[model samples]
Structure formats: C-alpha cells, structure tokens
Target: MRKIIFLLFLIPILGISQIELKGVLTTGNSGTDVWEYIDPNNGKIYAVVGGNGMSMVDVTDPANPVEVSHLTSVPGFDVKVWQNYVYCVTGGGGTAQIVDISDPANPVIAGSWPSSHNIHIDSNGYLYASSPGTTIYDLNPNPTSPTYLTDIGTEGHDVTIRGNRMIDAHGFAGTYIYDITDPSSPQFLTIITDPDITYHHQGDFSTDGNYLYICDELGNHPQADITVWDITDYGNPTKVDETADPSATPHNLYVIGDYAFTSYYTAGFRVFDISDPSTLVLADEYDTSSATGEGFAGAFGVYPSPTTGNIYINDGSGLYIFGFDGLLG
Candidate 1:
C-alpha cells in the first residue's frame, strides 16, 4: 500500500530532465477532454478540445497552433478522434456529436446521438458511452452514421473496451468487467474493489493488457490518487500498487509505450514510468495551477499525439503541449 505524495501547484520540480513544453494553444475559460486528429490529405495534425463547443486546433506547428475552425455545440466533456471524424460527448444530459474532419479547417457535424456522456472508442471501431448505463455504438465504413448496438444495465463513471472485454471504472461501486464480444448483448463478468479507494473515476490498461491503471477522483483528503490492479484475470483483479500526491485528485489518464500520463486537477500534469507496475515510479510533471486542495481548477485531461509523441493537455484555463526527447530506459 505504499504511495508517492506531494503538494505543489506552480512549476513543481521536474522528476526527470527529458520532459519539455513545446507549445500551447490557449482557449477561453473551458474544461475537459483534449483529443488529437491528423489530416490524412496534408499530414497536418489537429488538436481538438471539447468545451462550450468543439475547437479545432492546428498543432502542425506545436508552438503556434492556428484555430482554423470552431463549431459551437453543447459543452463537451469527452472527445475521441478516429479515422476522418471527431467524436465529442457532452456530459450532464448531453448528446454525442460526430464531426467530419476530412478537412481540418472546415469541420461539419456529420451526425449525433441522444443521451450520451463520456464515450470511449475501442480499437474495433466500437463506441462505448456512459450515463446511468453503458451504451454501445458501431462506427465503421462510415463515421457519420453510428448504429446503436446494445446497452448494459450497470452504470460506470468511465468505460473502455479491449478486445471482447469492457472495463468499467464505477466510482463507489468499484471496477466492473463485462464480456462485450456480442457488442449488442454484453454480460457482466466481475467487480473488483479496494478498501483504500475513494472514487474510481477512470482507468487505462497497460500496453500488454496485464495491468489496469485506475484514477481516484477524491475531492477532499485523498485515499489513493491511482490504484493499479493486476487484471490478468478479468474475473478477479488484485490490487498490485497505488500512487498519489498529498491532497491529490486525478482526472484523466492515458498510457503509451512504457509511460502513463495523468492530469491531476490541482497538481497539474504527471508522467509515470510504468515499465514495472509493481513499483511504479513518478517520471516527470508540469504544474499549471496555483490552487492546491484539489477543487477542479487545473489540468483536466492529457492527450498524447500518436503521430508525433507530443503531449496535449487541457486545463480550465487553456490548452498546452509538452514534448519528450526519448524514454529514460
């Protein structure tokens, strides 16, 4: 049950020297979901932020992003980019929006779904959305028209699909796993809970799918900021490790290669070396907020570009970009 904890909200000391800030594209007072889209026609990458509406940023020049387009819609809480379309999910009795990104500069709303929130698109082109229950959508061949597949009874704070299994990080209710092979008819498998966990908000599987990184979004005193589970067996997940800073509240997390990136609401951005999940180490961090008690006024989500390895972070204030030379291995 060992963990790493600290309290610093402004330019916290760098744990390593490899992390760097390349550029930033600032947006007005907005929060939640930072996703990236790469234009296939011109090879230019676009950074998409969801809030108040959808803002398309040309991160082609990481240091100087041009806001080519802004499509006003419901304030979005989550955004996903697949193929030539950008999918945005609005929480709080919101809808899902599908925008065609074939032309990054002129994105048009392709389609939308009613009653959707916090949607996750899997590798097989299946969209998993959460509300009181989980709703599945199949987006293939054409991104605009997503066919509703099935719905699961159990509700989740966040959901992700890997292969035929669905991982649901259900706060208070713990983490639940489901068999999603049937897409339209999912069956509950198991639920894993830890005594020290407060709120299980979201989770990300390791590259090999052997471990699950769970984020705990505690408002006041934190029990654990992140609880790692050995999910080798989906039926029975064992608590392997945990990490958190003093007075920490984690928001979103994404894993890439040997590293896992997280955005702590007040603690700013954190990078962890997950080569060894049993003894996860804090790799690096960048602080963007001044408040420290974790009341949701800092980094909201971290999106690392698959094409360029640059990190895109969205906070309540603005959007930022960070870069790394290479792994510390």
Candidate 2:
C-alpha cells in the first residue's frame, strides 16, 4: 500500500518537474511600450523601448526578471543584437541607435545612423536598417562607427538576410527578395505579392530554409492570418498553405523545431504544428483575453526561453511565463 502511494506521489512530482514557469521582468507605471525583445550573445536580456525609449533587463533567472538599466532615446520600435552590441531603430526619428551592451546591466550608446523601425544584422557583421527603405551599414571593423553602404528601399518594411538573399516584408506591398551576394550593390530579384493580403507584418525562414512563414497583421476579414510560402526558388516564391482561425491576427511569428509560435493581437499566443508545411495544423492555443476588449487583453510578444522550456509572453499589463507540458507534447 505504501508503495502505491509513493508511486502516485512520484508521478505527480515528475509531471510538474517536466514543466516550469519563470516570470522574468516587469515594467512598472512608465506606460512605456516594449516592442522588440532579443537575447544577445552574452546571454543577457534586452528589449526596445516603444513609448518612451529603450530598456535592458537581466533575465538570467527568468523567474525573477529585474530591470538592470535603460537608455532614453527617441521612441523606437525594434532591437536586434549581434555579438556584444544592441542595435535599435527609431520609429519616427529616422535613425538607428547603436548601444554597446558588453555589460548587460549598463548599456551605453555606441553610435547612431539614419534608419527606422526594424534592423537586421548579417553573419558578416553588416547591419541592415529598414524604414523609408532598406539601408546596409558596414559594422565589421568597428561596431560603434558603421560606414553607411547603401539604402535599398525601393519598397519594404522589415528586412532580413538569409544566406545570399535579402527579404523584405513590404507591408501592403508584399514580400520582395533581393540578391545581396555583392553587398555593395544589391540586385532586385523578384517580388512575391498575394492579391488577398493587406499587410505583411513579420516573418522568418524555417529551419530547413525551404519555407517562409509570413504574418499578415490584417486578418482575412477583419483579422489577419498566417500565410506560409515556399521560397525553395528564392527568385519565384510560391504560396504553400495558409491557416486562419476565428481569432487570427498574428503580429509576429517565430519558428522553432517543429512548431510555429504566433503572437496574435487579441488571440494571445497560438501554437501550430508545421511539421508538414503544406498542411500546417493548429496544435494548441493560449488566450490572453483583455478586460478591455476581446482581442486587446492578450499578448504582444512571445519569447520562448532558451535555457528553460518555459515560454515568456508580454501583454499590455505585464509579462507571463508558462512551462511547456501539454502544450509541447
């Protein structure tokens, strides 16, 4: 009888141990807009300031996330990190701020450039800024002093480079692909546009590099959907499949091993199994509904903890971290 009781206790304990939740940091009464969050090479936590400026947090212990320090720049939208530096893009100011975060606790502004909202860093240490268009900067020899290369903003919003191609999520314009083999002169290759789409918000290439998951901020009807495209042929992209739930208004998406985590506006965080890209299916969903409205209360950004299996979600109120158990299985 005692053995049976011991087994029961062990089972529950093991199950709970399989999953764990950690609350990293919380932003207080500042009413500041926390837009983009990135985990730098030094294993520190950094986030872009939207409403006010930029802030840094130490999430070494995700459970007790504490704000280390912050630098006030004109309000910015997104942040990208390469090596020991943090690159932030201002929304309306039209410039990118370079901060040396070699020390996570105290970040110092290294330099600035005429850029906007989103910034991308390539493997070669080149920084690409997206705003009025796509601008490339050479941040190789010295990060603090980046030499402006050229701006390729014929059309696009957020720009990212994979292998030899530069992809742009051109808002209502659609997705554009360019060849950046010659960094100095980027040759426009092709433009992939979906007639039924409105806004192409954010996306990333799959681990396999064969497909691209594009998030349409504007839902099909009044809400957006997750549109998957086959970029096997970078020059001529093809649409594979699209999934639209009644509560689909995906703002940003991140692709993990076999799952795609979507940060939807009012729907919160929705998870889908993309093991089969053509037939992507919904696996599970967590709703962070707001008391303000149906789709307003949930999550703004979802960051899957690198060290821990838990997932951190940022909403209008604060940050919520949850362990992956039934959700992952």
Best by lDDT: 1
Kindly list the per-residue Cα lDDT of model 1 for residues 1-329, writing each as its tens digit.
12344423222464443578888766542478888887778888878887777888888888887788887864567888888888887775656778887887788888877656588888788888786677788898567878888777565678877778788887777877888888888888778887787777888888788888888786245467788888788767888888767766888888777888888888888888887865468888888677787567789978876668878888877888888644323
Tell me the tens digit of each residue's lDDT in model 2 across 61-121. Answer: 6577666666675343566666777676665456667787677667788887776766678
RMSD of 2: 5.3
Weakest 10 consecutive residues of candidate 2 by summed lDDT: 28-37
Each candidate structure's TM-score, on Cα atoms with residue i matched to residue i, is 0.88, 0.79
lDDT of each prediction vs. the true structure? 0.77, 0.65
In model 1, state the lDDT of residue 21: 86
